[model samples]
Target: MTTTAHTPPAETPPAQAREQFRAGLRRPTSGYSPGYAQVNLIAVPQAQAFDMLLFAQRNPKSCPVLGVLEAGQYSSELLSGGDIRTDIPAYRVYRDGELVAEPDEVTDYWRADLVAFLIGCSFTFEAPMLEAGLPVAHIDQRVNVPMYVTGTDCAPAGSISGPLVVSMRPLPPDRIADAVRITSRYPGVHGAPIHIGNPEELGIRDINSPDFGDPVEIPEGWIPVFWACGVTPQAAVMQSAPELAISHAPGHMLVTDLPNDQLQVP
Candidate 1:
């Protein structure tokens, strides 16, 4: 269910990964398929689809649009034969911005008027970070990445407005520059570190406690590095309270056929 990538796990194809998720395997998807891209999911009703798209455009750092499925559509070229309703590790169902249920599969909650947005996730760059000898704390500790709801407000769009959320990984002082360099190359996936040393500057009072996912251990002298999170859209969903919304459970991502290298820049 969890992996420490000191010795990387055998690669699993995106189709095979989706089959496992469809069959009810539920866990954080990091380090599962080393080279393939992973995406965060947020699906809302057809009526508010334009507003949601606008919200993403306004907050590109946290909501980089990867590939979107049409209103009522469930499958896309991203996952190659995967169904959006069942291919993720878990789902969160929200009604008017209230979290009502979290289930392994969301086929029962699927709506014909729903439009799904697949946003790029920072997990897309984790493999590259590891390859560069920069340790990923959550993966090593075998836990979901810690995410904090910061005091900084995101640029609002219509009814969708919320606080900025960030994912954290502790890195040694020496490797901080390398981590920044590696992630900056993949701008589509949350990009580089937004806040490097002080969590207080980001309005995060405590580093140990996170609003979402599990808290990771930060070794002495290792600073917490923050990245714009895909979960930020879910934060907006909670605050804005749309009629109906569905999203991936934090840390549970949808593995896609797209390779990680395709997103890297020279």
Candidate 2:
């Protein structure tokens, strides 16, 4: 007998929020998501939104926020068709520096006291970098970009505070300058490299092992370059442990109504 498998619609589902989130995460649409701007997500209590937005402004490099949602509203009028509660494929729920569960959907956890934040991710910036002939080791090797919780301190906002997180790329000496020039034009998505040579200076002890994502080959003639990452905010939210918090699973960004090219400063 041929058995039929059930599949859920792309829209947010009322039941099995965690399952829905997992379904969205099965694959990364990334460039293929088509016409949608990818976004980083952070869910926090309504009381913390003001302080968090202030933190984002103070640390633009690490927390380039794209949109903010008032308590109890999942739809983002600012991003146009952006739905905070269901747009993304996956979300991680944390309590006091510990990740308790990563639900596929968060509707059950949605609260009147919660505020949603859409921050910028480095994934969009990689599009231009690849177009410019810069090598993104992760994509080339079919691995994730290595993310590290650096010793660098973020500008604190009330109870939210943590070390800055960074994503690394190894580039040939010939391409480093071009990489800087292209990325600098898109400051909203992590602008440029924070470190170019030694990872130790940033308090990264091991180059091969990373706190998050997979490490790539550092071939001869190529030096490691690092950029501030959107994960910085999630880390802060996790550390704060404000009774409840949620964020997109790393790399599974919310596809938005905005265009990626618009991130560039004309």
Candidate 3:
């Protein structure tokens, strides 16, 4: 397995982070360059672009589309020359919607008909959350945020539809309001908590066992807060079973030139 067991230092710039991934450093990108924004990646055949776009439109919270690249184009104008095929620390290749391999790079999977979509990531709000004195468990623990498939279904668009997915962070009951206030400012990044408290309410049978990413322990008096996640699109793709699709492995996002503050709304 291609493992993201190590990451570039927090002081590393976005370009250098990309360089590390390009050099085969496969590590989860939770705290790399704190102020920079990170994005979830999804590349699919151009033939399915319209449906994918429509899907994002219908399910904006879970699939907030940041930008979409032209077929076969790997660079994004929004991300400052970052190559989609090599900039992310890890990539997952899905054939007929089933994940086939988790690789450090996807140059061999590149094709002329593939169009890449950059989606907003929840990691974008962590810097602000931390600044506000709230604890983000995954970052403190150095693990991927725990994610789960929810019972709620996303609004369907063409052939793209699936259960909503969420990332969980355990927050103290008293600080939940502050966490909400801070994160709600960044709607572009899957802002705010979609659910709070009981995990079973969201069809998550085992809070310790997430559908994707790593699990974190809930400290005493803390409640499990859920946020709509970019991984939702990958779940939708798997259900729709597109011929081929590629996504940033959970927690391994595409770091961009855009600052996190730029994504904040009034």
Candidate 4:
């Protein structure tokens, strides 16, 4: 069954949004819990923790580390009262580097030797962009942002490394500069556009077809802008082929209590 995009009520609190997810609301989190930060999640065995940390360090643009929870810990001090295992809408389980299951909750798969990493997501910046009157196409279309695996290769670190992944948004030629300026204030999120215009330059053969997430309409005179994605780490984990790894399903994120302005650069 195809799931239509549904925007969460404007007054919904972060806790309420998470409660909805905990109650089995499996939907893309693009427009939920307005003004709160949303994060990407990846849980790996402690044995692979060092490599994962190095991977994030080497690819800061794509894998900006937000918080790291020690082995078996589910809650994050950075996001007070946030629980990692049950807060997200959907979870992807990878066994031997292949996706094995997409579950609503990962409580059953939790292991004492697992370490969870929270990565900053671009979704955190969309609010400011919208406030600035810069159009966010996917949100308008009620779909997930389009993402692609780029030809760009991330710097290798220990056992983890892979091609950079990017999320795309089409902006009016006139509004592109303003969009960049608005997003540049949030370095804790994705920061700014890594590439603008010409998907072919990024080795994306078809702009209409994306490696992850759904495609949105690119109106006439709009140019595609690409931003570094937190999902890059998932691609790296897939390449590393660890014994077990867990991540949020594409477009599903861990909504946190931290406000979006908290991530703005000084």
lDDT of the structure predicted as candidate 4 = 0.88
* Best first by lDDT, ranked: 1, 4, 3, 2
Regions more than 4 Å wrong, model 3:
1-8
Two-way lDDT contest, 2 vs 4, winner: 4
Taking every candidate in turn, the Cα RMSD to the unseen true structure, in Å, is 2.3, 6.0, 1.4, 1.3
Q: Cα deviation in Å at residue 200, candidate 4? A: 0.6
Q: Estimate each model's TM-score.
A: 0.96, 0.87, 0.96, 0.97
**Per-residue C-alpha lDDT of model 4 across residues 18-67, encoded as one tens digit per residue:** 88888888889998889898999988999999989888888888988889
lDDT tens digits, residue span 1-266, model 2: 01112232254322233234335644343343332456778878877788888889989998898888878787865445445666566678877667887666777778888888888877777878888888888777666667898999999988788889998999999999999898888788888888898999999999899776666788898999999988898889767767778887776666665677788986
- Candidate 1 regions with alpha-carbon error over 4 angstroms: 1-9
lDDT of every model, 2 decimals: 0.90, 0.74, 0.88, 0.88
Model 1 C-alpha lDDT per residue in residues 1-266, reported as the tens digit of each score: 23222333478888998999899988888787889999999998878888889989999889999999988788988988789999998899999999999898998998999999999999999989988989999888878889999999999988789999999999999999999999999989999999999999999888888888888889999999999999999999999998999999998899999999999987
Sliding window of 10 residues with minimal summed lDDT for model 4:
1-10
**Candidate 2 structure lDDT:** 0.74
Kindly provide the TM-score of model 1 when superposed on the true structure, using C-alpha atoms: 0.96
Q: By TM-score, how accurate is candidate 2?
A: 0.87
Off by more than 4 A, model 2: 1-25, 34-36, 77-82
Residue 57, candidate 4: Cα error in Å is: 1.0
For candidate 3, give the lDDT of residue 44: 86
Put the candidates in TM-score order, highest first.
4, 3, 1, 2
